[model samples]
Target: MKSEKSKNGLYSHFRLKSSMSFLMALLVFVFSCSESDDGQMQGPEPVMPPETSMAPDMSMFDDEGGEENRVNTIQNWAYAAINVGVYSSILYSHLIVPVRAFKVTINQEAHFNEDAGLWVWEKSFEVPSRGTFSVRLTAEVDGTDVSWTGYVSKSGVFENFVWFDGTSKLNGESGKWNLYESPENPEAWLSNSWEIDREVGNGNTSFTVEKEGNHQGSSITYSIEKGADYDRTVLINDVSNSNLVEVQWNKESKFGRVKSEAKYGDEMYHCWDEQLQDSECP
Candidate 1:
């Protein structure tokens, strides 16, 4: 009987140990499920570097000043061309190279900017030869106002060079132009040559003449008239020598038609359409 009782005790002890182990496993599984149901597992958040505190560089602004200077240079040259054209036209109209005496009136006030070193003037006047002429002048000032005056002879020589008080961007510019008959025939009176100089800068930004021509047919007359339809008409007639050229331009369309007839050539017509395309006379 004692032996049987000992066997029963051993079996009971094994059952209790197994039951305790199973309960422990069930509790562990339940804890894992609860953690899974609660969104994601919690941990420390990642860190980022501190923000910087520095100012931006300002060297880019310097280029703007340089660009403005370049624009001023271009404006100065453009104005110079206008002034030269006006003076040349006047000389041609009078058939006088010396330009003994003349008067110029500037209707618009001279545009002067002391800080930017810029000056601009625009005006229109009448010339005996050119009929009516308009002019514009822009100048750059280093210390004083820049100006120049020159005279061209009938034989295409530059004389009486005069420099104004100021410095000019075209100070050293010089150009010569000649119109000859043809490459082979040298004997021709229907040709002329002229030279001009802008007594400023490097003097290389102008036209040059390699040969001279001798064409003295007759005095050329130029007339510019404004039309009723806001159009402009330029008539160049040398009727004494059988040379005539007429140009008409629309103000809004900016289209132009040119008809030219010369003593030595056939009649030619050209047109610039509204789209700024060049075509046969329309």
Candidate 2:
């Protein structure tokens, strides 16, 4: 027979042990059902922009084609190409260098922010054409879109210029990009808003550039599509007058056509030879 004091002590010890076992089992169940990243998981990075070759690389319509080049001929293609070239200039001169800098993930490092649940890429890089720049890219999940932003600070120059921002599908089927004016032109910084929309799985993209804040007379839409007779097709919309300029060309043959009612007075397609001179359509 055990003493009363010994029995009481044994009872208390077994009771405490049973409570501990139940507490541990409850903790195991909670953690099993609700596993958290605890701020350690790396988020997804942004996708690289569509190819810039989406813009046609054609010489200016200065000589040869003349007035016929100006209108009523394949010159409509020249005219539309001219506008696209302008937007290309803005992108290459002010915005492209930074985008090219951090897009490569091979050597770039991405830091994950647990609090914000974002993946940030920052780097200082030099372009042979342009000087060095500090570029930062951030990406986070937003509904069905992966929201991303790009900020650039030139070396020994201005800091924190939000050169661009946009969102893409998590699977990268499509997206839109908004570009701002360079910090050098502060008066128009963020005043310039251009939109880029990518077609789903078709390898095509359309860019609409708004002039000043006006979309009536000066807006231009440039798009690229794959074609049958031609390897590539380009469509440019003169949004003000609701006119469409279409260019179809073979990449190797370098022959193409331009069709527009605003420029040619008819929707008939006009052809240009390999030399980009006026020719009869087939």
Candidate 3:
């Protein structure tokens, strides 16, 4: 009877220990599952998108209407006239012989007509021994060309002159001008002027003048060619007739030279030095 009781006690103890171990395992599994559920309740991390850029505003370049275009055209015409008129005054005043050494001051006035959309500019200057010179330029709205008129008064005599763009006839004379540009040299430009059948002393005369220079520098060179009948006199001086004349000058140095061979055995070879004094040709 004692042996049987001991066996029963041992069996009961083993069964109880096994039951407690199973309970512990069940508790551990329940806790782990609860933690997993908590994680599932929270959604996936937020995904960031890429940034984008904005386009530029191009409204400033757009023309609002035809008024802006018209205004721009008028402004361009006026500016071009101013430039050409100023240069022409300087060329005729300082580049030509006889009065090449004189000092000149130019006064300019500009006006615009809003109703007619026209631009007019006047430049006046005095040349020693030559009297007063006035140049007037007029341009219509959107016109491709400008009309120029010049007047000179000396002593008591007044003379009127007009310039021809080579395509137009002025004073029964046809004159033309050509502007040249060099593709290889951006600083170089040349202009040539020609006139045929220009009334002079007794008959008509033909003349040509070429100006070549680099705007980047202060030096310019000119070549003049002329042809006229024996009975005809030159328009410039009326003293002599010439076939060819060459001139060169440095505006910065305020020095220049001229060489000419006249038809009547008169030859002119002069150089204006930096001192503004006439000197022997170099």
Candidate 4:
């Protein structure tokens, strides 16, 4: 009987211990599940996607209606009208002759006028930018090929007289003389002749004492040197009505060459050959 009682007590003690361990494990599992649920609720509020910045469009500037296409016409300058013909010959590739000296290039529609004409273009040109440019002029004169080389020094200024013969000697006298249409080949004239107080006489050519009413002072007598060269130039005593001066020039061509007659206040200057002419400046 005592053995049986001992065995029963041992069995009851084992059963109690196993039931307590199971209860502890169940409590731990419930607490762990509750903590996991709390962590999930606290996670960062669905991160609002970072706001993206948009770039402004440039489509408005690309409009074709507002576009402008400019027209460009280029005038070439083949040479720079230096005051010296020797210099011009060196600078220009063409032969420097007495005939092809003073000239300038103009646009096709331009025409030269005698009145208030100070080497200007009849029609103006629009320059795209300022820079040195090559200039050339070509014209068929009676089937003869005539050409000139020059340059455009200024963008706004029209290409005018080359600094050949006329510029060689007469930078001071430039703009003081007038260029007119000549009856013949050289095709230009200068007027305004007067008599000076200085006595200039030659045995060959006679200066008749006559009243020059337009001259502001007393009529003076002076003679130009008599020769074939002098035959082309007319002697004058005054030019500006106050100063005594001599006017000398010939007709446009070699054959019909005669001393130019001054009509008082009119002075002649060579347009095409002024660059090859003698310099009045020392």
Runs in model 1 lying further than 4 Å from the true structure: 1-104, 108-230, 238-242, 263-268, 280-282
Give me the displacement of residue 230 in model 3, in angstroms.
40
| lDDT against the true structure, each candidate | 0.34, 0.59, 0.33, 0.26
lDDT of 1 by residue, 1-282 (tens): 999999999999999999999999999786664333334321211111000000111111122224444245322222222323332443333222112211231234555433433455444445455344333434443322233222121213322222111123332222111222222332321212212232321111111112232223432222223343414443444333455555455656555555655521555656655544454554
* Quality of model 2 by C-alpha lDDT: 0.59
Q: What is the TM-score of each candidate against the true structure?
A: 0.24, 0.64, 0.24, 0.16
TM-score winner among the candidates? 2
Task: Write model 4 residue lDDT over 29-96, tens digit each, in one string.
Answer: 86654334324211111111100000111111122221121111100000111111211232122221
lDDT of 4: 0.26
Q: Write the per-residue lDDT of candidate 3 for residues 1-282, one digit (tens) a residue.
A: 899999999999999999999999999887654334334321111111000000111111123235544245333222222322333343443333112211121123446544434344555566567556654433332223333222222334433333211222323232233222221222212223333333331222222233343222222222222331112121222112223443344434534444445522446545555543455656
Give the TM-score comparing model 3 with the true structure, all chains together.
0.24
After superposing candidate 3, which stretches have Cα over 4 Å from the reference? 1-107, 113-117, 141-147, 151-156, 163-282
What residue runs in model 2 are displaced by over 4 Å at the alpha carbon? 1-49, 52-77, 94-111, 127-130, 184-201, 211-224, 239-243
- What TM-score does prediction 2 earn? 0.64
Q: Give residue 42's error in model 1 in angstroms.
A: 99
**Worst lDDT window (10 residues) for model 3?**
47-56
Q: After superposition, how far is residue 213 of candidate 1 from its true place, in Å?
A: 8.3
Candidate 1 Cα RMSD after full superposition onto the native fold (Å): 32.8
